[model samples]
Target chain A: MGRVVSAASAIRLDDVTLGYDRHPAVHHLTGEIAPGALLAVVGPNGAGKSTLLKGLVGTLKPLGGRIDRGALKVREIAYLPQAAALDRSFPIDVFDLVSTGLWRRRGLFGGLSKGDRATVAEAIASVGLSGFERRQIGTLSGGQLQRALFARLALQDAAVILLDEPFAAIDAKTVSDLLELVARWRAETRTVVAVLHDLETVRRAFPETLLLARRQVAWGPTSEALRPERLLEARGMQEAFDDHAPVCAVDHAA
Target chain B: MTPYDALVAPFVEFDFMRRALVGSLALSVGSAPIGVFLMLRRMSLAGDAMAHAILPGAAVGFLVAGLSLPAMTIGGLAAGVAVAVLAGLLTRTSVLKEDAALAAFYLLSLALGVTLVSLKGSNVDLLNVLFGSVLALDDDALFLLAGVSSLTLLTLAALYRSLVLECVDPGFLASVSRSGGPTHFVFLGLVVLNLVAGFQALGTLLSVGIMMLPAASAAFWSARLSGMFVAAIAVGALASLFGLLGSYHTGVPSGPAIVLAAGALYLVSIAFGASAGLVWRLLPARRHRAA
Candidate 1:
């Protein structure tokens, strides 16, 4: 029901080191996400999965390296952070929240035409939330809220979509429904990078996988990257870093 | 005096009371929605800070022009916007949190205001600056208030969608449109302009109460943001009406009387208003959890 975005855009990271306060969160990572690839970013807690997404979205610049956003404008990226990051108590209805996706084409004060309203309604139905259009977002349960967010993303209709732990604390039915939407995006050749914990779902749905633990541990087909030994090694590497480490005096990366 | 004499006679008999009513009504029309946005943005205290921040600028205007309306209004507008802008900048660049930066700037502004007013005038003049002269609003003050109200309503209507998007999902808005920055500054400008207008009627210290309290009270009755906006303006107007009567009958200070009336309304709404009122909590099914 949403507009089709152009395919054939790749994202490349050249030795990117992302961090806060000069203390590296994701260090010395180099990789390329091929055009239209559905990649799952799998890592343990503190493995910098979210940090890498932040880098790709241009929210946080690499402390050392370059990210070449090939063929895709920075505005053509749709990022869905963890549901917890959103303020649920905010007084917004589902329809208005979804319509925010039109801000690019319509602009700040742009009036919504009847056609725009129809498009928003179609996006809401695509996410299985048609009846909840006027419902306040705060009243929704966790699954419903995730559905609303997906509706917003559908309205966004961007080329590159990044989802950070979108399935956390959600029910199985909602997970499957959202997975179907992701599959649809893949069929349309839109690049989808999701930070996921459920390895089984990653193996079943994602074609490519990127394992990160303060660095690139592995990047390949899901089968190759999701091996038990590789997963264990990534977890160990993430946990080994001291949580209380002070800021480094000098950045060793040139 | 009977009830009619107490309530209706003051407004009907005296031109001053009528002028004060017009002044506060204009203030309510503009400032209430600004207050609603502030609460939505979690900037209520920052709104207070900006309110006090206007004082030094208005005092500068007062000193230069001897209680002229336009000078003080312009001065207050500049000061309020400067503080909002500076606080935003400091929060983005430095380690200072937004709340901390706002507190620091407002305290400095308050100190500057006190110093500026004391430099030229006696305590009587100081009283007017701090407490305002609602009953004595001359033609210029009335004109300023009405003009600001018109400007504020027009600006808000233009920026409505963007402003709401900015509050709910700023990250999404930033990704989709470049309008976020200009929308934000415009909203802030309106806030400052409204504060400058409000200072003429309610004074710096008590003016923010008129802006915030009714909006906060409105939240108890309305479920939607738009509903809350209308309810807040209505509540602000109602408070102004009765507050003037209270001042006329009881001889309490006018500005504080208005604020205290709003506060009382807030309390009543918290306990008995429709949306999240305390009466719902006392219902049997809900009372089981409390028990």
Candidate 2:
């Protein structure tokens, strides 16, 4: 049990390879993420973006890699899986759903303290769902449900947060509000990593990016890594668009 | 006859009938909450498997300890837990699915229990064990039913929040665990313990039906967990009382009678429950059109 020093790099994955069964999804990848930075992992469908996020949170163990952290145990990582994976018919109120994040602190056989309740309230407020605590989760719209999930993660009070496709299928206003909240999270100096599909949003909102297509194609600032030629190369369409100059430089810093 | 004479006569005349009614009511109340969780987790069939698995243990206890209720119940509980743990471990470690493992173990236990009873030359008592004879329940059996049901209810109340969380969202629990293994095992153990205790009143053949049908029917009427739990208990208690009366007058088996009552309630729920049931939805449309 190592204590995470304040303001240290949150995650480090070295030569990681992961897949379902024997079919490889992410082949030999290496990356390092710093604290207080929002990194967008962008790729097309079936590009192993979700797999990478799972690997980070220790849900899907990598077949081969040395994944280390700077004194921050993986339990300090909060994850918001895609909303579709949730059972919508579960009979729980919004507050109870958010309160699940406090499960660890309650320990075995311990009840929720006043401090725990306060944190839950703060988490709900942070997600702009203060007065909706008693509402059933089933009745919430897609965006409100997502916010409730985000509130749960906030209650976790983790140093790192990983989200998989948090913006998919959500309305435009919800996308903006969620992005605004992510920016606030960065301002609070927590590490935020999201798997985003909208390239334009990624370019505008995320400062750093990791572009993937079964392998690490580019890693750098979002604007530099998301060049049209690099995107083409990552998609394995280099032969089809060979005439265009490779506009982005691949950084070997990772 | 007056209503008071009819209601009070059943209790004053027969001690065995009084004991049977009281014992079944206690068992039904405790089993309802356990049943609700089992149905929610989609492990309704596991309850069936556990109920049947208790027979061999009960038979072995009877042979060794001379038909002592406590010895038999302890043996049955141990066997039920063993089979549940084995099935769970097999599913995790091997390629077998949980349902397949449960089915395999269920059949094995049933066959072994029958053989064991035959070896002891207690085939008559085997029928008693298979379909409980409420008339044969003694003071000791009644005490055991009351004791076990009370203990199970207390344990369930203590661990209510964690158990419900585990059923509804296991991912949240996993996110907190380093390996996410032991917490899951504890929940599964609780489920096995619940079914084992419930097996005393509801026999192997119909215990699962008693445990699941009430809860499943309750789901049609309520969208909240607390509401479903209350409704399930009400349904279970009513079924137990009605089944006891039916068994007394009609000479039907108590276990099957209770199950039939529960099944009837389930049908009514499907027709008239508030949420998605046929009558609840359809009648409203008709009334609106008429208006």
Which candidate leads in lDDT?
A: 1
Mark the regions of model 1 whose C-alpha exceeds 4 Å error after superposition: A2-4, A238-254, B1-3, B285-291
* Residue A96 error, candidate 1, Å: 1.4
- What are the runs in model 2 whose C-alpha is more than 4 Å off? A1-5, A113-122, A237-254, B178-191, B274-277, B286-291
What TM-score would every model get versus the actual structure?
Answer: 0.94, 0.89
Residues A136-168, model 1: lDDT tens digits:
989999999899899888777788999999999
Question: What fraction of the reference structure's interface contacts does model 1 contain?
Answer: 0.61
Q: CA lDDT of A41 in candidate 1?
A: 97
> Where is the poorest 10-residue window by lDDT in model 1 chain A?
A245-254
lDDT of 2: 0.76
In the range B1-291, model 2's lDDT, one tens digit per residue, is: 676555556667888768877877777776777778778778777777777887888778877885567777777877777787888899889999988998899789888988888887566677666766656677876777687678767777777776767666767666775323554455556555555445556555566666788888888888888888888888888887777767766788877888888899889889987765887655545434642
**All candidates: DockQ:** 0.60, 0.44
